[model samples]
Target: MKNIVNKTFELFSELEHCNNDQQKWKIEEMDGIMREMSEDELNSVLSARMLNKICQMIEEKKMSMENAILLLKCIGYCTMLKRIRVYCFNDSLVNKRFKTLIVDEYKKKEKKNEKLLVDFCECYISLSIYFPSGLLSVCVPCLQKVAFQKEENEEAQNEVEMALMALSNVKNSEVKKELSLNEITDIIEYHQEHHNLTHLAYQSAWQFLIFRFNMERSLEEVIVNELHFVREAARELEELRECVDWKRREKKKGEKEMKEVLIIGRWLDVIVHFFLSCQLWNEEFFGLIGGIESAFQKAKGEHRGICKECISSFTNIERNRAVTIEDLLKGRAVDAVVKEFQTQTLNNEMTYECLTFLMRVLRRLKEEKDEMGEEKINTIKKKLFEKMEEEGHEDIAISFYEILHFFKRRYDNGLSLDISDYFVNVRENG
Candidate 1:
């Protein structure tokens, strides 16, 4: 490796001032040497030497950007060579110098060509690197472009995914905190569509939002408002749930469809995981619970249980949903939620959750001044209790009395109501 590096340098220096004929011969010799060198295993020193030279040539304008990109494909792109990229990319001096070329060859050219965009993004991953606060600015613009790409090309999209995946790697780095962006919303709005690279793209977008939230103040509006996302997430879940029976149909015909069904089930689980994995400060992200409720309503049997898992997550203290009990009855929304409860009343677990949120929402509504809101709450309370009693759910029916009192002013934070008889009544009736 040392000998080859010395010889390659001598030849490179000669080619810099050689006559045209001599230059041509020197170029051929250099290419031959590079090919030979690449054929051997690349250690950190050799790889850094090549990247250092590439960086120097491009910086000095001695090499055309086009040829530089090609030369990278010839040498820097070796799968085997990448194993040592970890070592080479860690050298801060070399990494810093390569930034200029990355900007010139990749950042500037990303939108003009998908192939370059992919290559650029892959460079982030292929290059095991740190993104100290200011050092990562060069890649930020191109990262946005990669996320919102409209093309359906698999490689291009996969590369976009790779670009996002690279961001995840730096999330724990020393300077990791926030990534400020001028076009954060644009990237998000353009990418509501599901990507070919699902988790990669999803986490990439989510992490960006997370970073911006931590780094940038006054971004609460963007971070919390994603009703469309809720709708699409629920829609995709129901679509996957709808396909569950297809496996049985295929089995009846002896077509062995369980494998395909299993894949769809996994995707449903993916959606579940996507929502469940999110960490956010709880706010009234209106329509989200409604969307989840809608997903729960459409699912059946085993699928319904899966949907319930997601609902149960949102109800927990750590993962509490953005939607509040108040958002439930804001408009005609209460109608659909109540109608569904009426239909699913026989589903004991579903009925219990529905009633819990319903009572809490009614109390929230009662605190509001709108007469219609008050009337709406009374109507909901009447319908809710009647169903609980009609279905003989004594515990759920009686619990509403205490849950609603939670909305009223407390007296010494002690027993405001005579619950001694309430539990006894519930026990006797239930």
Candidate 2:
């Protein structure tokens, strides 16, 4: 077994100078060796030697970029070899192996051997063209080292570009396969760790997963799932914000980090708006919104100068366009709020902001007024006030008063006022 392993290494070593005819001979020899070796023997030998062999060919300048790519493709297709290859190349546990190999190679060379390092980096990048999924796993650390060296090697930069292109193509292919949510999460986690230096790819992967998930379910359903991710992202933002705040006591670096936190906060706000627009109100959901609002309020109080105006504009637009409890009860929207308290709480808001939104929705409903029974409207109004008192928001009482007054003045003078008051009394009695 040892003899066969040594002979295999020798053949790999000779690949650098091997011509087309020699390459054919080497291929045949490798095939014959495979025919004789047990599966276990083959696995052991390949696992121990394949990366070293590839690196040797690279160092010797015998491996063409094209052939390096072909070899990885071949390894990918080899059913018996696929697991080992993925283990070595894609598994995060083996990251240290690639890192060690690159660092050891660098240590063996003189300072002026920068060209050799650049060539090896280029070759490593080429390997990604064949196994793009694994490329980010294996090559990113090495690329980061190169980037850190601050060497102005255009070839090295192009190699990173090419690897990214290949990764993009692989992602497109994966998306078309209708991968499950778990699979998408796995891909995201992998890229998140491996491509930390290039945030665009990670962000793109996240957005793609979200977009695809949204296509299969209503926005309401998507919002429920999004809650989990949103909370996780928000926690990270809070940590980042703390870090920035601490840094602000010393330097200006905090500003850039704060911008990242703000961006994440804005995304969370957008997600909240989506949930609110569907009238999918729940205690937990409201708690999340209240938490964000509180954070924004604190930031504003601290004079942190967050984009409050923009957030207000977005929140108002969402509320005005949002489906109301009445719309849900009438079965007039995609998502229906079925809970009695939820429906009531949604309607009793009286803040200038809330009133403005309510007026807009009420105007639209009146314009499209299909004769809903006065009794049903009264029942809904009663439920709303009862829930408001139950929820301890007495401010809603005044809002209801103003809404009733508006209806009287706008429609039939005093005629509508009596009908509206009748429902209000029924609500109070109930």
Candidate 3:
């Protein structure tokens, strides 16, 4: 690690004296060093002083397109580390300097720098994860300008995709400030009318838009009551069903089918994200339960996990009037979660969601003294305990015990379960 630190400083010194052509190579060399860094090495390098040095270099150097991308890739990688995320969150200059760089590059009227724009989007998305509030207020407008600008070129399409993804990462406060209702309406209509963008691009745009409606309380009524949005969701569900059927029938998906599955998975994500924030669930919307279940059953890998996570959300709806434990049970929520635990290796997020759903169910059932719920609880307990015995899951086991302890004490005291008690552990992945 000391050797790695020395090498990094050496590259920085070389960058200072290097010519533009040589600078590119130096940055590339820097990228390689950062790429090979261990977690501790990354943490070491991502200090305030190092960030200041990086900002100075970015300001001083007339970096080539490739060099700028290389530098940003290194920065992007650092932003992904858990410790570095905490560091970035506490540091305001990192956000401001990078946002200015992205905006300045964006405002340049020469031929568009497509790779730089995408990297800017990627880096900004990473920053937004830690600085969710005001970080994107200025940057998002620039992304929106390019994202909504009509251009029928490959460069335009890729930038639009990245920009939409960046917008999706914007916080609710910034989202409300940056995006207007008319602009939001335009995005929905524009994507519906245009097919020039790839499925991923359109899905990202939708994800961004839905996230806005979900986060901004003012738009909740618009999303829930809007007939057009419901129609679009219905249409997307039909397409999702077709994809689910294809996955069921095909033994080995070719490249095209794999792409199609991924696209469909993104759409599933959009729908789930939308409903996850819905304040109420009407009958017509709830009728789509069958489709959600079928997709969960047939979809593979992460997509299937996404479906299960979505189904898990059904039981825990905080504001929805029509969502009952009985409704969730009938929709086969318990069965889907149980099957997942029995058959699949659950990720942290999925494990938490599934456990949250069951805990809620058990709490409700215990209050009502429902015998069937008792049977279901016994089955889920068996599966979870069996899972606890596996290796590399000490964190999960700890969470399991915490949840059990919470319930035992709550039941003894005749107190209701508070979901907030366990909410902090959801980001345990970090």
Candidate 4:
């Protein structure tokens, strides 16, 4: 096996300088050797050696860039090796296998070859189809390294983006085996943290859920606590946006800042999708709805848009019992529901459901005048006014205004109108 590996590398080395005919003969001979080896033997011996040579070609300063890319692609196709992952390349008198090779080397002031790294990332993502853990072991660390880099410069940002794209590809691909719950928790924690809002690594976001694991029952407890992480991300973004333009805050900032908002959005988006897939939102999970509510309260601009989408996925009742307006107000679920109209983002059906809930709350507030809920009632009033102010606002907004008018009509003269007059006035005014 060692002789065959040496002989194969030597033939390729000569073919680099030989004429076209010699190159064809070398490739044909290499194909014969590959055909002779069993899959298990190739996996154990030949495949690993070929992968090492490919990495060597990448680092060898004497080799051409075109040659390295072509040779790697040839190795991928020729052996059709699915299991072996290359660990080391350079001989820097070291023991680490792939030290800093995952990222492009910072050569002097400029970066080393970037295309080579991208091609390698893409190749590994492809290999992930057969061996999920193999690709993940390599990509996860690189994803973390790039995601947390502190440099604010464009080059640093691009490296982060490249890492995300690579991980996203792996996460996006269909896989056969699911990762264990313990394995997924760290990834979930990383993306959900407030630290990520400033420059979120969108790539690390989806790898956890790519296979749609049966983790709902196993992971529910941790998931409940992890939700607050998304809430903090919103708070961080709100602070950042507020700091950026303290004077005229309504004027949205540059696209770069908006992308920062989206980083949080992307993380929350994955969490929502993963949680819903678990199909295991017990009462405990429902209680943590406050985290999402807090997120809704501070969320603004694009952040609010993301929160609005997140709300639709989490409407659950403990049993056959209905989720009353009182419960929502106490838990601040009203804030999340009201975001749909304040942002004018939800479709007509969801908008109507939200409006119906608010109308019930508004009517109850007018009749009962609960001093305990005074602050919440006031907030609802202000949000309703804001919805009315928005242009092209839907009928749901009008229905809300009519509900307010109905309540006004009932007690305007201290002699409350009868039920019949209430309906009559609402239709006429509406």
Tell me the whole-model lDDT of each prediction, alpha carbons only. 0.46, 0.41, 0.56, 0.44
TM-score of candidate 4 on Cα atoms, chains taken together: 0.40
TM per candidate comes to 0.42, 0.33, 0.57, 0.40
Model 4 Cα lDDT, one tens digit per residue, 1-430:
3666566667766754655555556666765554344345445444444555545544654344445444444443323222233332222211122334443332324655545555555445423333345445545554445545556577776565545444543433333333334444454565455344224443243434333334244454454345443344335444444434322242345544444444444555554555544444344333445545654555534343545544543343211123333445455565556556554433334444444444544455465447546566555555544543443334445444545434445434222223221121111121
**Stretches > 4 Å off in candidate 1:** 1-145, 148-150, 165-180, 191-207, 214-217, 220-287, 297-300, 303-305, 313-326, 329-376, 396-430
Clashes of each: 0, 1, 0, 0
| Candidate 2, run of 10 with poorest lDDT | 332-341
Off by over 4 Å in 3: 1-53, 59-66, 73-93, 99-126, 129-137, 175-178, 214-218, 225-273, 287-295, 298-319, 324-331, 341-355, 362-430
In lDDT terms, which candidate is top? 3
Q: Assess candidate 3 and give its TM-score to the true structure.
A: 0.57
Where does candidate 4 stray beyond 4 Å? 1-119, 122-161, 168-198, 202-217, 225-252, 278-327, 335-430
Tens-place lDDT digits, model 3, residues 185-221:
5776777787566655566666667767755777666
Ranking of candidates on lDDT, top first: 3, 1, 4, 2
CA shift of 164, model 3, Å = 1.1
Model 2 C-alpha lDDT per residue in residues 1-430, reported as the tens digit of each score: 4566567667766777787567656755765554344335556655535765665565576775446544533333231211122344443322333445445556674554544444444334323223343333433343333433222356544343333322322222223322334444554554444543233223323443444443444434543454354444344445434544532432243434544443444444344344434444432433334344444434432322342332333234335334344532342111111111122432332122333333443343444335555566556556554544554434443435546665445443332332232222343333
Instruction: Estimate candidate 3's RMSD in Å.
Output: 10.3
